[model samples]
Target: MNANKTLAIGCILGALAVMTGAFASHGLKAHLSSYALSIIHTGVQYQFWHALALVGLGSAMLRFPSRRLGRASLLMIIGTIFFSGSLYGLAITGMKWLGPVTPIGGVLLILGWFTAAWSFWRPDTDSVKA
Candidate 1:
């Protein structure tokens, strides 16, 4: 992902995470069970954290520009969609099928972190000058 795109997406995700939290707490509290609310909260937390990570990745890319960082950004974006999206859908609709997708998203998130670590530890040839 390009630095600008990553940053934009991160900001959007962060905003959505906050909105989701507020919506769940205020709007859905009476409608949803405690367990459902817990699930939504978990998704909101993970999405918020990943969003911040993407913002950081975008800033780092502006300095160190690497293909690996781009890959990490893509993975994180997809992972957030899968993980948080599924949780929100599942909690709201009680969709059991989405449960399986949550783990796949978790795996993608883990991969994203590993890829980011690799980029910093063993950067590409076209990486930072200093």
Candidate 2:
């Protein structure tokens, strides 16, 4: 995706992370089991971090304009959506099928981080840092 779109998505994800965290802390705790809360906690943690990472990637892209960074940012978006999304669904609705999807998202998150690091090596000529 383009930098502007990515930046907007990052911002949205950041907002969602905060909102989800608040929900987990205030509202979800009462209704959820310890295990469910833990699941939400883990999801929120990863969600928050990746949201910031997405923002950073967007900012970096604004300066550098690297395709690799764009791809990395996209992966992070996918990861955040699936990873956090599944946790929220499973914990709230008690659906077991969603559990399998979480690991896929985790793998995507790992790949996103690796891609970001690799961007330094296979950087676009237009990249600011490169």
Candidate 3:
């Protein structure tokens, strides 16, 4: 994905996370139990961090458009969807089936970070020196 596109998505996700957090705190406070609220909070926390990571990934891509970085960014997005998304679903609906999905997302996130590290470790032969 293009760096600009990745950055845009990251910004959007950050905005959504803030809105969701507000909604959870104000609107859902009365409806959900403390436990549920905590769960939702965890989801929001992970989402926010990952969103910020996306921004960093975008910046890295702008400086160095490595294929590994692109793949890592994609994996991060997927991780956010599955990890945070599953937590949100479970918190709101209390469904047990979504439990399994969280681990998958976590794995994706770990892999994404690993890929990013590998990308940095291996220098690009095509890059021109300033």
Best by TM-score: 1
Model 1 agreement with the true structure over 40-66: per-residue lDDT tens digits: 999999999999999999999988898
lDDT of 2 by residue, 1-130 (tens): 6678788998898888889889888997889999998888888888888888888888878877887888888898998899999999999999999999999999999999998888877775536443
Q: Judge candidate 2 at residue 106 and give its lDDT.
A: 90
lDDT scores for all predictions? 0.95, 0.86, 0.88
The sequence of per-residue lDDT tens digits that candidate 3 reaches over residues 72-94 is 88999999999999999999999
The C-alpha local distance difference test score for the whole of candidate 3 amounts to: 0.88
- Total residue pair clashes for candidate 3: 0
Reference-based TM-score of each model: 0.96, 0.90, 0.94
The residue ranges of model 3 lying beyond 4 angstroms of the native Cα positions read 125-130
Q: For residue 16, what is the lDDT in candidate 3?
A: 84
Give per-model CA RMSD: 1.8, 2.5, 2.2
Worst 10 residues of 2 by lDDT: 121-130
At residue 72, give the lDDT of candidate 3.
85
Candidate that beats the other on lDDT, 1 or 2, i.e. the better one: 1
